[model samples]
Target: MANTWNGSDDPVTRIHRQCRWSTSTLQMTDLESDTTSECTNRWIHIRHLPSQFNIDLLANCSEYPLFDDFCPYLPNHGLGQKTHNRSHSWYRTDSHMLELIFHRRMLEYPCLTSDPDAADAIYLPYYAGIDSIRYLYGPDVNSSFEHGLDLFQFLRHYDSSHIWGKHNGHDHFVVMARPAWDFSQPLSNDPPIWGTSFLELPEFYNLTALTLESRAWPWQEQAIPYPTSFHPPNMALLDSWVSRVRRSRRTTLMLFAGGGGVSASPNIRRSIRLECENSTSTSIGNSGYSKLCDFVDCSNGICEHDPIRFMRPMLQSSFCLQPPGDTPTRRSTFDGIVAGCIPVFFEDQAAKSQYGWHLPEEQYGEFSVFIQKEDVVFKGVRILDVLTSIPRARVRRMRESVLELIPRVMYRKHGSSLGLRNKNDAFDIAIEGTLQRIKSRLAEISVR
Candidate 1:
């Protein structure tokens, strides 16, 4: 087992060590102050909620089939295909990684403080996304509203002595693993939808919520990317994988690895599939079982759900097709980026607006390709032509930009002793951005 720190080190010594390492390898030019010092100094108090709200929620893992990560590639990053000796298994459908990452990191994070009085913010570590999904498929699935009500009751009746009570929950925040659409269930007498009514509650108005996707309204909510299968245990491992990706040769112009492309639906999936099949250089791969088994040969479930199978083709392709999945944002976007492929996004809002904090603040053209959905659906504009139109040099720059953004888009190493010391992993950026927002909010309140 790695020697994980338990916040016992002297603050000055740790900060200086972090500074020395960060200045050498990582530099956040966009960040104003010293990121290592700011992140370590920002104290956060983790709320102790009942197991029902978090861990115990996944007790009956059978109901939530996605939690089943017993595949052959359990914890190997290289998916058992790569020749590299240092690799860890990662599952694409493992949405539970977000909760696991947070739970493990909070313990190791230097900012976390047991004392509420010294905390800069209160973190409500409720597994909101997972709990909601459990109810969505459980006995009282129709009455998902009850899930939100139960949480509201928990917060309203929570101990007022807690730091959350001081600011009417303004200083408190929660990290949700699912998109906001999963929790923003309608309240009216209209037909029932997919998710719970958690975000609809008045109690969550002031508190900050970090979700995989966020609605444009309610400025308190922030967008985060879905967790991917690539998790490097240390900076060396990360550097090694990145170096391999940089050296790998990419031949294909583009590729699309998705199912459910047939059935004549008006969805972009089918459109993308059609384009991929028609293109000369593009390859279409399959993984998850889809009803389009007859149209596509691989749809017979040949491509098993594994990290290598999903990302290998991506690494060989120059561009990866990213159409909206069930939600506006797809996990494939991050996968494509990590694989060093330039993502071609059909909807601008999907990646451009959703991940403002973590993604580069510059124009989307710098790192990705954007073709308006209407162009493909109505105008019949060919995806291949649009991609081919871009100059080769521009495409190269975009792919390089995507490669640089990999560390920021990826989840940090879980249970690391350094606690994002020299790396700018996704968790580090999210927490740092959240802290900055909290400080700004407190400053605004003070001035008012």
Candidate 2:
């Protein structure tokens, strides 16, 4: 029998007491009183899923396609390995860990309610991102939809209260680590093009999804930031990094840290690389344009092993070149924002059409530069000439704007007890957005 004293509280009671204290502290320090009340009223209920959908996927990571050993990326509650310093909050976080990170963060969310009837929104903790990888490269492509089908089938049968059936999943949300394209595979493709048909199911139609990249139409999906290496545990550490980047001495005009042939058209990356190489010798008037650009040859996976090699160049450069890789979006866009370097995007779809929930469409010019892919690849337009033409004053303003957006794009370290006053990081913004979306949908339904 467990030890029980006459006047002592039980273990469950003690845990509840701690949770109440933590929630109260967060309410007083993190958000305004009004915001706290609003969040409290909008309670979330996380669905208790089977182990196979989440934990089992991580336990058998090696069996996943294309990865030799995937266990390293699953440590520290999906924050990956701590890089260099044990004291600092930097980790070698994989971009695909959004599902893991978001799930862990949601578990600690103050708005969580145990009573399903009182929940304003339902959270489906499915590891669709990691689960999709299993069927991506194998001959069993047709079986890619099996896991998703199984998940919804279980939900339909096991949910005694019909939580999802209440609004046809309009009030429920899921965070997908991968892009929307990976789950939107059409069933009519003769050879079955690259992705699973998870999104095509009639059951997922009304569900709200947060993904790294959303489709152009964006009916039920919203774009969220990809996880970066720096996960600050407190506002102080985040502020320190921001101050350091603001004070960084940028000597290079531009930087391209990735390799070529990542996109279907190799010419785009090739053109950018050639420009970076040729600019080393070319000079413009008085700006030391001879050292115009720096390029890191990440062809051998050096950037993955050591992020400093990729981040150092970004730190010293005024702008980071972000070309489309496979898709119109790249994780490097968020990396540039974290380093306080202005992003130079080659496609409108890369930034303008995507990330509308976090990054306002009107503010694109304030923090980033857009160069047409056609102009760079086909017209042979000089990247240096265009960048150099921008006045020093404008560049400084853009960098400042980029720095200001750092917190919104970052995922705060899970289980952080430190108080963050009046600031919402990526996770907070995502939850607020999801709740607001669900609230609005529920209100509309009530009127009918």
Candidate 3:
């Protein structure tokens, strides 16, 4: 809780609390009121804001604007404007500027950058677009990356180290991205921004039956569409969120637990039919096209789905698919867990070191099942019984554990940003702590 101890005459410490963010229930603080004589009846007052505050830009909702350069590590992408792949909704070639996204900051704090030369570089974590506002709301693609930079600039406390070019050793990496199969797509090589995808959490949430709305990063906004009355996913009118919430207010955040793709035999990178012995038919076929080919598939007959779709029926699934993307760390491993599906890995030596991020054995060991490509046939034999025999409670537990991580973790507030809160504008317990941890990690690397 916050240490806002004022004078006496305050309400009893047991007063109930309320938060604006929680969809299921409200929360309260646990503190005794100051009843001292001098402060008696002298209440520690706070102004309640109007119920409907526009959080889209965080202007009226924020107590104060963060400095532009106070925090030197965050980048100033100036509204994420770009000139590439006009078809890409996430990134646009026109009409977007990272600088103009927020109008008031520039005019109000012309001298926002206090010491631009102070910090070495900024690190912007990457996650799949599934978690970014752009994916849900549409485009701002390049702008999305820019906001990451500008947002940190808005804080003015630390600058993001997005040294994406041929830079090395100057900054720490902040991984944030989704699973993409296109090897042609460039993953930033910025310092302090390691790994490829932001889908780093265990894949438990991907397959569960829960309706999670609280786990997305930033918490303030949703990157993916939920099946709700306000933000409905498909045209499934029967599956309205309002009706679902009416039945039960508890809705778990929906996770893409995004999928990944493994390259064929090193010599056959362009092979249409994959020959992995023990892999799931996740979008491949015995004699069909691969998931990678699906995205770039041609609309007309010119682009035919060789085996009809991505996952081939004859393709076998293993415990874990160790397909790290172009930069390595393919999120498919995590996705398999969420979908109650297993992943298969074909060791690409270069990918191993590049994605040596949080491929932890402790937190994820209980769930994932890995196998070497050398023994694809025999090693994959046990997955059948092991996956089926897992208890129901174990599944639920995975859902809870992964969902709980949304707030205290990536979604946790690090500084003075207005976070996703309950109706009472409750503060998150992890914001400052998250910042400290990141700072400490950077310190460990001696990037300061």
Candidate order (TM-score)? 2, 1, 3
- What stretches of model 2 exceed 4 Å from their correct place? 1-36, 85-87, 261-266, 288-290, 444-448
Clashes of 2: 0
Best by TM-score: 2
Comparing 2 and 3 on TM-score, the stronger one: 2
Question: Could you give candidate 1's per-residue lDDT for residues 1-448 as a string of tens digits?
Answer: 1212234342223333443443343223213254437655487767766556765553444454443322222122112222245444243435544654565555556555556666788787676766776556666667876665666677667655445557777788888887887788876625566777778777777788888889888778898887777766677667777887787677667777766667776767777777655644223223111211112223533333455666777777777887776677877788888899888888866888888878965857789888888889778988776876777788778878888998889885554436335777888788888888887887788787
TM-score per prediction, in order, is: 0.80, 0.88, 0.30
Compared to the true structure, candidate 3 yields what TM-score?
A: 0.30
Model 3 regions lying over 4 Å from their true place: 1-328, 332-361, 371-373, 378-382, 406-448
lDDT of each: 0.66, 0.78, 0.25
- Residue 116 accuracy (lDDT) in model 3: 22
Give the per-residue Cα lDDT of candidate 2 at 342: 95
Q: Write the per-residue lDDT of candidate 3 for residues 21-76, one digit (tens) a residue.
A: 22112112112232233222121111121222112222111122221111111112
Give the Cα error of residue 315 in candidate 2, in Å. Answer: 0.6
lDDT of 3: 0.25
